[model samples]
Target: MALAIFDLDNTLLGGDSDHLWGEFIVEQRIVDPAVYKERNDAFFNDYLAGRLDIQIYLSFCLQPLAEHSAEQLVAWHAQFMREKIEPIMLPAARELIRKHRDAGDTLMIITATNRFITAPIARAFGIDILLATECEKADGRYTGHSTDIPCFRDGKVTRLDRWMLENSQSLDDSWFYSDSINDLPLLSLVDHPVAVDPDDKLRAHAEANGWQVLSLR
Candidate 1:
C-alpha cells in the first residue's frame, strides 16, 4: 500500500493550529496577552515569509507548558480543541483521508506543531502515525524545550528519513499533501505532491512544477 502523508496546519485544517494555540492561551490569560500576542503574531508572519527560527518559536510556545501543571494544560487543551479546532475542521479533508483509507493506504500526519497540541488532533482524524515536534518532559513535567530537530523545513525530510528507516517504509508511490512552501523538501520527495489550499509561494511553486493544486476549504 502507498503511504499517504498529510500536513496538519492549513493543509487539512482551515487554520494554523500552532498560531491558534498561541491565541487560545492569550485569551485564556495563560500568557501575557499583549506581549505574548505580539510575539506570536511576529513569529507567524516570519513563518509565512519562510524565515522562521523554529528553535526560538518552540521555546516561546513551550514555555507555557513549563509554567502550568500537566493536568491544567490537558484541561486547557480540551477546551481549546472544542473552541478553536473543531470549528476549523474541514469536511473536505476528512473525505480525502477516507479516500486514501479506502484505498488501503497507510495514513500519516507530519507537522511542525508540538505533539502536545497535535497528538489529539491526529487521533481525531483517525491517523495513528504522527511525526511532530516533541516537547521534552522531565519527571512527568514539561521542560519547555524540544528534544530533537524541529520537524520543519528541511528538518521534515530528516525526521521522515529516520522514521522510514525504523518502520521499513519507503517513499516509492507515496503521496504528500501540504499547504506551505516550507514543506517543499518533503513534498518533492513524494511520488504525488498535492498543494491543498496553498499559500501564495507554494501555489506558485506547485504551478511551476505541475503539481496538483486544490483547495480543501
Candidate 2:
C-alpha cells in the first residue's frame, strides 16, 4: 500500500492547532494572559513568515506542561478537544482520509506541534500513525523541553526519513499534503505533493511546480 501523509495544522484542520493551544492556555488562565498572548501571537507570526525559532517557541509552549500534573493536563486537553479542536476539524479532510483508507493507503500525520497536543487529535481522526515533536518527560512529568529535532521545516524530512528507515518504508508512491511553505522540503520529496489551502508562499511554489492544489475548508 502507498503511504498517505497529512500535515495536521491548517492542512487537515481548518485552523492552526499550535497557535490555538497557546490561545487556549491563555483563555484558561493557565498562563499570564497579557504577556503569554503577546508572545504566542508573535511566535505564530514568525512561523507564518518562515522565521520561527522552534527551540525558543517550544521553551515557551512546553513550560506549562512542566508546571501542571499529568492528570490535570490530560483533563485540559480533553476540554481542548471538545472546544478548540473539534470546531476546526474539516469534514472534507475526513472525507479525504476516508478516500485514502478505502484505497488501502497507510495514513499518517506528521506535525510540528508537540505530541501532547496532537496525539488525541490524531486519534480523533482515526489515524494511528503520527510523527510529532516530542516532549521530554521525567518521573512521568514533562521537563518543559523537547527531546529531539522538531518536525518542522527540514526537520520534518529528517524525522520522516528516520521513521521510514525504522518501518522499512520509502517515498516510493508516497503522497504528502500540506499547507505551509515550511513543509516544502518534505512535500517536494514525496511522489504526489498536494497543497491544501496553501499560504501565499506554498501556493506560489506549488503552482510553479505544477503540484496539485486542494482545499479542505
Candidate 3:
C-alpha cells in the first residue's frame, strides 16, 4: 500500500499549534520562566520563518523536561495533547483525516512538531504512524536535542528513505499533503504532491508544477 503523509501544522489544523502549545506550557508553569519561554519563542520564530534547525528546535523544546522524569514528561505531553490539540483541530481537518483512515491508506503525520505532542494526537486520531523530531534522552531525562534527524522538509525524505528501505517500499505511488513551502522537498518526493492551504511559495510552485492543490478552510 502507498503511504499518505500529512503535515500537522497549518496544513491539517487551522493554525500553528506549536506557538499555542508553547504559550500554554509557559502559562501552566510546566517549564521554567528563565529558559523555556525564551527558547520556545526562539523556536517558534525560527519555525515560522522556515529557518528552524530541526535538531536545535527539538533540543530546545525538550530542554524544559530535562530535570523531570520521563513518565512525568509523558504525562505532561498527554495533558498538552488534550488541552491544546483537540480543541484546535478544524472540523474539515478531522473529516479529512477520517476519510484517509476509511480509505485504508497507511497514513503518517510527518511534521517538525515534537514526538511528545504529535504522538498522542496521532493516536487519538487512530493514525498509527508519526514521524517527528525525537528528543535525545538519557536515564529518563531529556538532553535538549534531537537524537535523530528532525523530520523537517529534506530531513523527512532522508528519514523516510531509510524506513522505506527497511520496509521494501518507495515513494513512487505515495500521497503527500502539506501547507508550507518548507515541506516542498518531502512533498515532491511523493507521486501526488497536494498543496493544502499552502504558503504563497508552495502555492505558486504547485500551480506551475501542475500539482494538485487543496484548500482546507
User: All models: lDDT?
Assistant: 0.95, 0.96, 0.79
Instruction: Please give each candidate's TM-score.
Output: 0.99, 0.99, 0.89
Model 1: ten consecutive residues of lowest lDDT: 148-157
> What is the per-residue lDDT of model 2 for residues 1-217, given as tens digits with 9 covering 90 to 100?
8999999999889999999999999999999999999999999999999999999999999999999999999999999999999999999999999999999999999999999999999999999999999999999999999999899999999999999999999888999999999999999999999999999999999999999999999
| Residue range with the least summed lDDT across 10 consecutive positions in model 3 | 56-65
Quantify how close model 3 is to the true structure by its C-alpha RMSD in Å.
2.1
Pairs with backbone N, CA or C atoms under 3 Å apart (clashes), candidate 3: 59-144, 59-145
lDDT of 3 by residue, 1-217 (tens): 7788889888777777677677777888877765777877887777667787766566566667576778887787777777777777778877888887788777888888777667777777677878887877777777766668878878888888888898787776789999988988888778899999888888899999999989778
RMSD of each: 0.6, 0.5, 2.1
Can you tell me which runs of candidate 2 are displaced by over 4 Å?
none
Report, for all candidates in order, the number of backbone clashes: 0, 0, 2
Q: How much is 44 displaced in model 2, in angstroms?
A: 0.2
Residue pairs of candidate 1 with colliding backbone atoms: none
